[model samples]
Target: MKRYLLSLRLFWTTALSAQLEYRFNFLIELIAMLGTLLGSVFILSLFFSHGNKIGDWTWEAALVVQGVYTLLDGITNTFLKPNLSEIVNYVREGTLDFVLLKPIDSQFWLSTRTISPSGLPEICLGFSLIIWSSNRVSNGIHFDHIAIFIISLFCAIIILYSFWFLIASTTIWFVKTWNATEVLRAVLASGRYPVAAYPPSLRLFFTLVLPVAFLTTVPAQMILGNINLLKLFTSLLFSIIFFNLSRYFWKFALRFYTSASS
Candidate 1:
C-alpha cells in the first residue's frame, strides 16, 4: 500500500511538471473557462427573472444545487476525467501495456496519472457560491449539517468515480470509446439542477437509473437540512452496489483485453 501511494505521488509530481512546461496554455484555458462560467450564471439569472419556480425549489436553491455540482465536477475533471478520456487511446495505441506491466494496480495508475491544476479555480468558485447561498438561505448552517454534507459529498464522489469507471471500461469492448465519455458528460450535466425540477418520470430515472441525484442534489440537500433519512440510506446502498459492479465490470473487461498490435 505504501509503495502504491508513493508511486501515485511520483506520478502526480511528473504530471505537474509536464503541465508547468506549458504554463501559458494552462492560463489561457483557465481564463476561457472563467468566461464560460460567467455566461452560464448570466443565463441562469435571466431565467430566474421570469419568476418561475420549478417544483418546490426556488432560484436560490437551484444556485446551491449548481454550486455543489460544479464543485464535484471540478474535482472529477481535475483528477479523473482527463485520464479516463484517454484510456481508449492508450488501449488502441498499445500504451496501456506499459501501465499493465507495472507492479501497481493499473486502474489506479491510469486514473490518477494526470491532474489539472486549472480546475482549482472552478472548485474555489463553487465553494464561494455555496457559502454565499448558505448565507442567503433562511435555515442557518450548523455543525451537524456541515458534517453530514461532507460525508454525503464523499459518497457522491465515489458514486461518480464508479459510474465513470463503468463507462471507461467499455473501451475493452468498443476499442474506441471517446464518444462514450462525451455521452457520460452530457448525462451527468443534468445533475446541475435540482432533481425535483424535472418531471416525475425523469426524476425517477435520475434517482434510480443513472443515480445522478445522489451525486449532487442529495448531498446539497443534506447540507441544506432538507434530506430525508430514507434517501440517505438509499444513496449509501446505491453507492456500494455501483462501486462493486464497476469493479466487476473492470475485471470482466480486462479478461477480454488482447492488447494492441499483439
Candidate 2:
C-alpha cells in the first residue's frame, strides 16, 4: 500500500508538471465550463418559468441536483477521460503489455497515470453551486447533511468509475469501442437533472438499469437533508457491486490479451 501511494504521487507529479506546460489551456476550459453551467441552468429555468415544479422539486432543490452532476462531470474530465479513454489506444498499440508487466497493479496504473488540472475550476464551481443553492432551499445545509453528502458523493464516484472502466475494459476485445463510450456518456448526461424530473418509465430505467439516480439524485437528496437510509444502503451496495464487477472484468479481459509479439 505504501509503495502504491508513492507510485501514485510520482505519477501525478509528472502529470502535473506536464500539464503546467500548457497553463493557458486552463483559461479556455474555465470559460467553456462556465458557459455550459449557465446554459444548463437556463434550460432548467425553462421548466420553472410558469411556476411549475419539476417532479415537485423547486428551483433551489433542483440546483442541488445540477451541482452534483457538475461535480461528477468534473471528475470524469479530470480522471476517467484522461485514463480510461486511453485503454483503446493501449490495446491497439499493444502497450497494455508494458502496463501489465509493471511492478504495480495495472488497473491502478491505468486509472491514475495522469491528471488534468483544467477540471479543477469546474469542481470548485460545482461545490460553490451546491453550497449557494442549498442555502436557499427550505431544509438548508447542516453539518450532518454535509457529512452525508460527502459519503453519498464518494459512493457516486465509485459507481461512475466502475461503470466507465467496465465499458473501457471491453477494448480488450473490441479495440475500437469509442462509440460505446460515447453512448454511455450520452446516457449519463441525463444525470445532470434530477431523476424524478423524468417520466415514470424513464425514472425506472435510470434507477434500475443505469443507476443514474445513485450518481446524482441520491447525493443531492442527501445534501438537501432528505436522508433515505434505504436508498443510501442501495447506493453503497451498488458501488461495491459495480467496483467488483469492473475489477473482475478487467482480469477476465486480460485472459484474451495477446501482446505485439503474438
Candidate 3:
C-alpha cells in the first residue's frame, strides 16, 4: 500500500511538471472548458424560459442538478478521463507491456498517470452554484441533509468511475473504445435533468440499470431531504456490484492483451 502511494505521488509530481511546462496550453484548455460549461447553462436557461418547468422540476431544481452534474463531471474529467483514456492507445501501441512490467498494481498506475488541474475552475464554479442554490431554498437545509448529500455525491463518483472503467476495459477486445466512451458520455449527460423528467422506460433504465440517477438526482434529492434509506442502500449495492464487475473485466481483458508490437 505504501509503495502504491509512492507511485501515485511520483505520478502526480511528473504530471504537474509536464502541465506546468505547457502552462499556456493548459490555460487555453481551461478557458475552453469554462466556455463550454457556461454555454450549456445558457442553453438550458433558454429552453426553460420557453416553458415554466420541464416536467415536474422547476428551473431552480434543474440548475441545482446541472451544478452537481458539472461538479461530478469536472472531477471525472480531471482525474479518471485523462488517464483511463490512454488505455486504448496503450493497448494499441504495446505500451501496456511496460505498465505491466512494473511491480505495482497496473490498474492503479494506469488509472492515475494523468491529472488535469485545469478542471479546478469548473469544480469551483459548480460548488458555488450548489451553495447558492442551497441558500436560495425557502426552507433552510439541515446538517443531516447535508451529510446525506455528501454521501450520495461520493457514491455517485464511485458509480461513474466503475461505469467508465467497465467501458474502457472494452478496449481489450474492441481496440476502438473511443466510440464507447462517447456513448457513455452522452448517456451520462442525461443525469443533468431529473430522471422523473424522462419517460418511464428511460427512468427505469437510469435508476436500475445504468444507475445514472444515483449520479446527480439522488444527491440533489438528498439535499432536498427526499431520500429514503432503501434507495441509499440500493445505490450502495449498485456501486459495489459495478466496481467489482469492472475490476473483474479489467483482469479478464489482461489475458487477451496481445501487445500491439507483438
Candidate 4:
C-alpha cells in the first residue's frame, strides 16, 4: 500500500509537470472546467427561481446535491473517465500490451497516468459550493451527520468508479466500447438533480437498478439529516456489490484480452 501510494504521488508529480509545460491548453481546460461547474449552479438556480423548493429539498438542500455532483463529477473527470477513454484508445490502437507490462497495477496505472490537473480548480469550486450551501441551512450541521455523509460519499465514489470500470472493462469483449461511456455520461446527468425531482418510475429505476441515487442524492440527503436507514443501507449494500463485481469483471474481461497476440 505504501509503495502504491508513493508511486501514485510520483506519477501525479510527473503528470502535473507535463501539464504545466502546456500552459495554453492547461489554462483553457481550467477555464472550461470552471464554466461547467458554474453552469450547473446556474441551472439549479434557474430551477429554484420558478419555485421555493425541489421535491423534498429546500433550495439549500438542492444546492447541496448540486455541489455533491460537481465534486463527484470532478473526481470522475480526473480519474475514471479519462482512464476509460484512454483504455478504449489503447484497445483501438493496439497499445494495451504496454500497459499490461507496466510494473504498477494496470488499474492504477490506467486510472492515474492521465491526471487532469486542470480539474483541480473545479474540485475547489465544488468544495466552495458545498461550504456555501451548508451555511444556508437552518439546521445546524451535526458531527454525526457529517460522519455519515462522509461514509455515504465514499460509497458513492466507489459505485461511480465501479460503474465506469464496468464500461471500460467491456473493451475486453467489445473493442469499440466508446458508446458505453457516452451512454454512462448521459445516464449520470440525472444525478445532478434530486432523484425525486424525476417521476416515480424514473426515480425507482435510478435508485434500485442504476444506483445514481446513492451518488449525488443520498450523500446530500445524509448531510441534510434527511437520510433514512433504509436508504443508507441500500447505498452501502449496492456499493459493496458493485465494487466487488467491477473488480471481478475486470479479471473476467482480461481473459479475453489477446493483447499482442491479436
Per-residue lDDT for 138-213 in model 2, tens only?
4457999999989999999999999999999998888899999999999998998899889999999999999999
> Which residue pairs show backbone clashes in model 4?
none
As a whole number from 0 to 100, the lDDT of residue 85 in candidate 3 is 87
Worst 10 residues of 3 by lDDT: 43-52
Per-residue lDDT value at 183 in model 4? 90
Which candidate gets the maximum TM-score versus the true structure? 1
* Residue runs of model 2 more than 4 Å from their true location after superposition: 22-51
Error of 2 at 235 (Å): 0.2
The alpha-carbon lDDT assigned to residue 126 of candidate 4 equals 68
The lDDT, on a scale of 0 to 1, for candidate 4 is: 0.82
RMSD of each: 1.7, 2.2, 1.8, 1.9
lDDT (Cα, 0-100) at 226 in candidate 4:
76
Two-way lDDT contest, 2 vs 3, winner: 2
Per-residue lDDT tens digits for candidate 1, residues 92-206, read 8888889889887777887888887656666877788776786577457888878887878888888998989899999988988878788888999998889998999999999
Error of 3 at 251 (Å): 0.8
